[model samples]
Target: MGKPTGFMEYERSVSHAEKPKERIKHFNEFHQPLSMEERKCQGARCMECGVPFCQSGIIIGGMASGCPINNLIPEWNDSIYRGNMKQALSRLMKTNNFPEFTGRVCPAPCEAACTCSLNGDAVAIKENELTIIEHAYEEGYFKPNPPKVRTGKKIAIIGSGPAGLSAADQLNKRGHSVTVYERSDRLGGLLMYGIPNMKLEKQIIKRRINIMKEEGITFVTKADIGGNYNAEEIMKSYDSVILACGASNPRDIKVPGREAKGIHFAVDYLKATTKDILDRNKTLTPDFKNFTITAKGKKVLVIGGGDTGNDCVGTAIRQGAISVVQLEMMPKLPDQRADNNPWPEWPKVAKTDYGQEEAISLYGEDPRVYQTTVREFIADEQGNVCKAKIVRLESKFNEESKRFMMEEIAGSEYEIEVDMVLIAAGFLGAQSYVADAFGVELDVRTNVKTDAGNYQTNVDNVFVAGDMHRGQSLVVWAIREGREAAKAVDTHIMGYSNL
Candidate 1:
């Protein structure tokens, strides 16, 4: 405890984000970090309670309650309060291999489980984490330190997303030769393309990839493990193979006119836009041609109400969409926690993300239309989506079925003009091709099957992790899965694991 009454004495604060309209002008990180003094004050707000649930990383009420990696929140927050960033970074790296990525993208369950949030604001653990790691980088303290000894074990990881990268990092540090294969034209997988530049710049990923390269971990891009590349060859070459390929299959809305030319999967749209931005080296001009399935001068409809949906809203606005609207099948959550929800549990509440914020600023209303789903897309003679048929939905609990189900309201149907449609309805599971190529079994959820509390697959010397093993999840969870899978591989190789 840096200060016994720090919780009471100092209030919580965080980085100041750029105004929505201004930030939409370009796709880059928009948050302005607080000064060292203000950040220190924010760190001092940590209560460091007897039972620090902030780092517990437990599941409460079916949701992650804290840092899934069990980050040493209190220890690092105290270090920040004392202005010892070196110590803070050390503590953070002890558990999380990629704090910089998490600091920027993670939803920060740690803050939700903070004791202080029971009454007031939680300590700025995420922001404090970002400050520490960013400071270390600027001071050259965050650098490569390769393992001194080689374990003489070779490992191959498929997919270069967060999970695969973390697994390679861990196994390499354990003195195992690690080679990562990415199917995409570039590395970072979703981190490289699926996400827009405003959330996380591509250069940030490149910087870390450079460090990993210096540390002796080999990365191979444009190498599809199960696609054109031979999967059996990998298993034969490497002592053990870890499949960290994320859940790459996007779910689709099986409504009428689903094959409209102007409609696209959210991931594909985002990837194209991001790649265009990187290639052109600038934001698309407002008057630029909408030669492909882009949002320019179009009234866009996003068919989901999650982070990806919000991302679509923001991306469309930047692409000069005339208007944007999002549809959600579920009912809107309460502004505050309900009776069934309490402290230390993941709060299910309404949040207006950056994309929605921008939409509201420009369109004068929230883009999300809850309890609504598109029934069909109306395409033009040219086979482009010209409008959408949407219907209001109501929830009903069937006594026998024992679950609440969404049913359409008979008279609540409506039609609206739309030029482009983006489906942000989340992922299904790991694409089956990879699993088939590896000849690994899949569970009921279609995720790679392993015994409970394990990462190894039914096939010996084969393992899985991240979304591929656990279904679609957060980046933090992916990192946790990767680290855990690395341990399993290490143990299997040496008959024991000190990883």
Candidate 2:
């Protein structure tokens, strides 16, 4: 512990964000970092408990309670408080392959599981993490350090998302020749395209990719291993193969008029906008007319109450949507935690995110309508969606089935004007083509099947990790999966893993 009474001496302070209305004007990061002194004080607030649950990374009540990467939280907190950034950055990077990415986007389970949060506010772990990594970069501590000697073993990582990058990072550091293949035009699968730029700037992903390249990791873009190139060719060439392709097959809402022209999946909509941004910035004559999926002058309805739905709301607002409303089937959470939800468990409570905040600023009310769902999309004569048929829902326990069920309230159906609808419900699993090509078995949920609690697949010399193995999850979890998969692969190839 840096200071025994530091928790009492200082209060938790998070990074400041710009007003939602102002931030929605441009697709860029809106959070302003605190000064170095302020950030250090925030770090000093860490109590460094005897049993630090902040770094436990355990699952409580079916949700991740702490840092999944098991970051050395207390050690780094003390390091920051003592002005020892060298040690702080070292500790931060020890577990997480991408602190910068998590710092900006992760929900920070570490804070939820913080000891201080059991009573008062938690340590500003996420902001503090961002500060440490950014400080290290400014001080030139992130320079490339290629492996001293290369292992004869060659490895090919399919999919250049967080998992693939992390796996490649670990394997390369262990002296293996690593090459990552991405089907997309750029690397950082979801980080580059799925997530909007305002939440996480694309430059951050590119910066890290460049450093990895300099450090001897090879990256090949627009190379679809199972499609453009034969999967067998890669298996024959590399000593080992790891699949980190994320869960990208989105779940569809099968309400009436689902096949309407104006409806789209959230991933496709988000990707198009990012690609458009990249095209406009780099090209003299931007050819993004086909890439544009705009909500300009349109009344938009996004279905879902999760982070991706919120992102869709923000993107629509930025794109000049005339009005926006989001639909959530479940009822709104209480303002405070329920009795059953104790400390260290993820708090199930209502919180207005950036997108909703922006919507309220512009429209004078929260855009989320809870306990309701779309019954159907009313399409216009031109085959474009023009309205939505919504119905209110109530939950009741079914005594016969021992399950909670959504019951539509009688005479509660209503119609609202809408021009476009984006489905942000969530992903189902990885796409089928790649998994089929690799001949990998899939669990019932369509995720790549690995041995229980292991990353190795049924096929020899084949491994799977990240969303491909674990289903849709946080970026931190994906990074952890990648690191773990790399260790498994390393052991398989060298008969020992020093990763």
Candidate 3:
């Protein structure tokens, strides 16, 4: 309630994205933040309702309805409307430990559940949040303030992704010594490699890690907990251990010629490109004269149409891919939400993500082919994938299971040139090595198992969070899980928890 009629008076405005063609030229962040005044106006769009669904953080109709971390959206929006960046950030950090990362990569379920979306465009909650944090950084609001006292207790966090970082931050602030171990040569786990630079520049992650180091959190890299390091030794050393290693085991499609050399998991392919970018200190627009797994001049076929697949499409185009086709098992969704997908529920609609936009701009066609899948990979004399046999699929009701299932359509198989294939069919579960080494049990889905609504593992003094505890999910959800897991660990150690 900065202004009673603020919602009516101001129209929602968000940050502008660079032209697709121009942005694809560099592997860097493309969205330009709005000016302070403009962002303040956007903040004015918050209605501040009696029951603000924006922060409810509940599931409705089998989908997440609002901010999973329960951010105080209205309060921060009011702070912004009144030009109080400090207050805005203060309210923001109360719940979310890393607004900077969420503001960039999150899908913004808060906006989807906004009351304003019932009638008009939703408030630019994400950008307003980004503005608050970025402004805080530009100013001197962020400071490395270590805990004044130590609890004489030590904890080990396996993984340096969002979840592990947040958990380490919380426990360290609670006066407990925290150490995070990452198997990767660099820290941030997937943030360092799996994600492309254009979405989130690597420097931002470095900035946060540097501050955490100053705040008395220790990070160990190239430490493979289950393989190189002894899990039993770690259990003996730490008062408590938190496993935040994300679900890194990617699901693979079983098809003929799956062993072809040109076929790779999406995670590995993205990591290769990112590592090359970081090593070269610049975006190397590849000019591959021969097949080196880089997408230069390759006719690429991406399996699955999730965010990862879209990322592959974008990355390949930037690496000078001659052509790209994305296959989805499900059919394309409607441009607008259907009647079943009412407001306040997650809207089921087709979204053209940035990568697809780039592909369309350059290729003059959407690279995604819905309701189709790869039947086989056709390899050349050298046993490298040369083309893919695609088969169209149709949804049919199964009488026995009483569910819809996708079946291959008859006489719908076709072949197209494909020098590279990236499978982005989502993740199955956490890698079994870490859990096996620790003797942690796994659920039916292969996620680390625990009692429902609990973070404690079967073993004493061991806890789990993030993708390892749940499944592959957003960074925002991972942070929430880590914070919650920290609370459980703190309680077990101190006899009572105040996290």
Error of 3 at 243 (Å): 0.6
Worst 10-residue lDDT window for candidate 1 reads 284-293
Model 3: which residue pairs collide? none
Model 2 Cα shift for residue 138 (angstroms): 1.1
lDDT of 1 by residue, 353-384 (tens): 99999999999999999999999999999999
C-alpha positional error of residue 248 in candidate 1 after TM-score superposition, expressed in Å:
0.8
Model 2 lDDT-worst window of ten: 282-291
Each prediction's Cα RMSD? 1.2, 2.1, 1.4
Q: What lDDT does model 2 reach?
A: 0.91
CA lDDT of 139 in candidate 1? 94
lDDT of 3 at 70: 98
Runs in model 3 with CA error above 4 Å?
285-292
Candidate 2, pairs of clashing residues? none
Candidate 1: residue 492 lDDT (0-100):
94
On TM-score, the stronger of 1 and 2 is 1
Residue-wise lDDT of candidate 2 within 1-499, one digit each (tens)? 7888889999888778898767776788898889888888988899989899999999998999999999999999999889999999889989998999999999999999999988889999988998898999999987788899998899999999999999999999999999999999989999999999998989999999999999999999999978998999999999999999999899999988988889999999999988988877732122223347988889999999999999999988888889999999999999988999998898888999999999999999899999999999988999999989999999999899999998899999999999999999999997899998888999999999987889988887889989999999999999999999999999999999877
Per-candidate local distance difference test: 0.91, 0.91, 0.91
For each candidate, give its TM-score against the true structure: 0.98, 0.97, 0.98
